[model samples]
Every structure is written in C-alpha cells, then in structure tokens.
Target: SAVISQKPSRDICQRGTSLTIQCQVDSQVTMMFWYRQQPGQSLTLIATANQGSEATYESGFVIDKFPISRPNLTFSTLTVSNMSPEDSSIYLCSVHGQDQETQYFGPGTRLLVL
Candidate 1:
C-alpha cells in the first residue's frame, strides 16, 4: 500500500501564470503518475515521472506545459505552466501500490484559472 499527499488542495490562479503541485508518498514507489480531471470528465494522464530521468509525457501533453520532477522514489512535483481558464481542473498524483498493479492517488489540487 502507498499513501499519497498533495499540496495546495485548492487555488485560484491568473491566466498566463503557473502553479506547482507537490506529491509525497508514504513509501517508495516504482511508478508515479500525474493526471488532470477536467470538469465532469474522466482523468487524463499528464505524464509519468521517473526518478533520475526525464518525465514521459502523454499524447497532446508536453513537458513545457506540464513539467514533472521525480527527485526520488517518494517525492514528485508537477508544474502547470502558462495557465488559462481552460486549464481549470483537479490535478492528481498517483503511485503504484506495493502490489505493483493497484494505484493510490493523492487528494488532488484543484486549480481555477481566471
């Protein structure tokens, strides 16, 4: 099992700015992922953060827009750059559990860009 926590549970940002959301896991995890949940929509994977390596972004998502950092097994940060009203959503951090299949997610950071 893995417990995940995220910072800035909710925030209101201005357009053209950025926000960084932190993720911390209770234990080391092999895989960590960042996702975005738009209003009334399912989660969309932003990227896969790999420790000691550059993060792998998903299709239509770029590193410049959603940069990720995995400093170690249990810590990571995802930055949403150049914010816009369309970017308003709930950003989530998740980690693969000890079972390596099940994933645990942080509460999420809700951002509203105006």
Candidate 2:
C-alpha cells in the first residue's frame, strides 16, 4: 500500500494569482500522477512525475502553465503558474496502488481563483 499527503487542503486566491501544491508519499513510486478535476467533469491527468527527469505533461497542459517538480523518490510539487477563475478546480496528487496498479488520490487541494 502507498500513502500520499497534500498540503493546503483548500485555498481561495485572487485572480491572476497562482498556487503551489505539494505531494509526499510514504514509499518510492515509479510514477506519480497529478490531476485536475473541474466541476462536473471527469478526472483529467495533468502530468506524470518521474524522479530525476522532467515531468511528462498531458496534451492540454504546458510547462509554463503547470510546472512539476519531483526532486526525490518520495516527494513532488506542482505549481499553477497563472491564475484565473477558470483555474478553480480540485488538484489531486496520486500514486499507483501496490497490488492492482490503480491510482490512489490525495484529499485534494480545492482552489478557487476569484
């Protein structure tokens, strides 16, 4: 079993602002996934965090918009570079499950960019 933790459970930010969310895991994982869940939409994978290498981002995401950092095996961070009301969503950090390879998510950082 793998356990993950996220900081800033919820935050309300002003427009044109940005926030950085952190994720920490109890064990080393091969790949850590970051997701953004907008209201009423399915989970969208933002990127895959690979240790010692650059993060692999999804099609709609760009490095300048969402910069990811995985400095070590057990830790990583995601920064939302720009702010907008549209950026308001639930940002989650997850790890692959040990047995089934299913991804397990964090409690989520609820962001509201006003």
Candidate 3:
C-alpha cells in the first residue's frame, strides 16, 4: 500500500504559467507516473518518471511541456508548463503498488487556466 505525503490536493492556475505537482509514497517503489484528466474525461498517461534518468513521456506528451523528475524511489514531481485554457485539468501523481499489479494515485491537483 502507498500513501501520499503532500497536500493542497488541488489548485487553479493562470494561463502561460506552470504548476508542479509532487508525489510521495510511503514505501520505496520502482515505478511512478504522472497523469492528466480533463473535465469529464478519462485519465491520460503523461510520462513515466525514471529514478535516475529522464522521464519517458507518452506519444502526445513531450518533456519540454511536461517535465518530470524522480529524484529517489519514493518521491517525484511533474510540472505542467506554459499553461493555457486547454491545459486546465486534473493532474495526478501515481505509483505502482507494492504488489505491482495495482496502482495508487494521489488526490490530484486541479488546475484551471484563465
């Protein structure tokens, strides 16, 4: 099982700005990822945060737009840069559970670009 150690669960940001959402797991885990959920939509995988290397972003996503950092086993952060109205969404930080098959997600940061 994993627990998120950060709060402020959500926030609203202005356009052309950026927000960094952090995730911390209770135990050391190997895999951590960032996801985005648009209004009334499903989750989209943004990237896989590698512990010591650059994050592996999904097809439509890019590192320059969504930079991720995983400094250690249990901590990571994802920054959504140059925000726009289209970028307004719920950003989530997740981790593969200890069992591996399951995944746990943080409460998520809700950003609204104005």
Provide TM-scores for the models.
0.97, 0.95, 0.93
Cα RMSDs, all models = 0.7, 1.0, 1.2
Q: Candidate 2, residues 1-114: lDDT per residue as tens digits?
A: 677899989999998777999999999887899999999998999999999999999999999999999999899999997789999999999998877478899889999998
Question: What value of lDDT does candidate 1 attain over all alpha carbons?
Answer: 0.92
User: On residues 6-30, what C-alpha lDDT tens digit does candidate 3 reach at each position?
Assistant: 4447777788898887888888888
Q: Write the per-residue lDDT of candidate 1 for residues 59-96, one digit (tens) a residue.
A: 99998999888889889999999999999999999988
TM-score of 2: 0.95
> Mind sharing the TM-score for model 3?
0.93
Q: Each prediction's Cα lDDT score?
A: 0.92, 0.92, 0.85
Residue 18 C-alpha lDDT in model 1: 92
After TM-score superposition, the amount by which residue 81's alpha carbon in candidate 3 deviates from its true location, in angstroms, is: 0.4
Once superposed on the true structure, which residue ranges of model 1 sit more than 4 Å away at CA?
none
In model 2, the Cα lDDT at residue 20 comes to 95
